[model samples]
Target: MPLGDEPVSFTTMVRGREIRYDRDAINAYLGRLFTLPHGEELCAFQKQLSRGNWDIPLMTRTLLRRNGGFEYSAAQNPLRVLRDEMATFTQLLLLLVLHNIQPCSHT
Candidate 1:
């Protein structure tokens, strides 16, 4: 587990070489990604995904708000599409971690 506001760091071996993944760079990338108008909602969804209790459809609707229904096609909305892709990637990564298929060694 990471301390409050601490950049997450972990190590994994691939092809007999250890690789370190530090979240500082990843966080920078994510920070840039969330600079759009729907950044808040996307950030909330990202946090929810991190906690393993995300609501995808609700997030989709929230991102494309209009009269309590989606105002646009999700495929046409980059933010919504990104949310979905992030959710999928997060879920897959979680499964990999849980299965020890891509073990992340804490640094």
Candidate 2:
């Protein structure tokens, strides 16, 4: 992302068309991409990111929609871009493993 491509918001704010979703939708989306233990629970942030989609102007992605909308990226695998869910997944892994919390993605 360029320096001023998107407004810098310290807090979570929808300045433009942003993909917002509830917990259920987040779980449903990420559940397919990753497999977790049978009884593990994904944190609030993890669930929130699973349903996230980003579309910055002037940047073209194979699946990023030209026009920001509520369209789901169900067909687009997040691991390709190393954004959104990847960061969230990394955070989850770090919190669990580095801190010795027993990672949820553990097989």
Candidate 3:
């Protein structure tokens, strides 16, 4: 449990290294510290991907006619592709945390 906007954990011990490391704790702390902000990052990345070479934000600078209706820009790729990429990224991120799998980086 955490206080309003406390941004700290209530489950951590003050003086020792002992702590809960079960599936429940992992589930609880998914947003605490040992996690990547996949949802937020993916949204930004998807927007970047969608706006790959565009200078403006997509859907914000649409053409507004005299009738106050706007025409959306055509998408380079189907929205499904972005959804699939985001889903795969999220799934792999969660799996890594839940399974305690170490991510190996070649870089």
TM-score of each: 0.24, 0.16, 0.17
The CA lDDT at 80 in model 3 is 23
Identify the candidate with maximal lDDT: 1
Task: Give the root-mean-square deviation of each candidate in angstroms.
Answer: 14.4, 19.7, 14.8
Tens-digit lDDT track of model 3 for 9-94: 53566588757766468777785544447655355668777766544333322322122322344754322212232334454665
lDDT tens digits by residue: candidate 2, 5-81:
88543333276655546555566768854546687677657866785654432233332333322223678543343
CA lDDT, every model vs. true structure: 0.54, 0.49, 0.49
Best by TM-score: 1
In model 1, where do residues sit more than 4 Å from their true spots? 1-9, 25-42, 50-107
lDDT of 2 at 90: 50
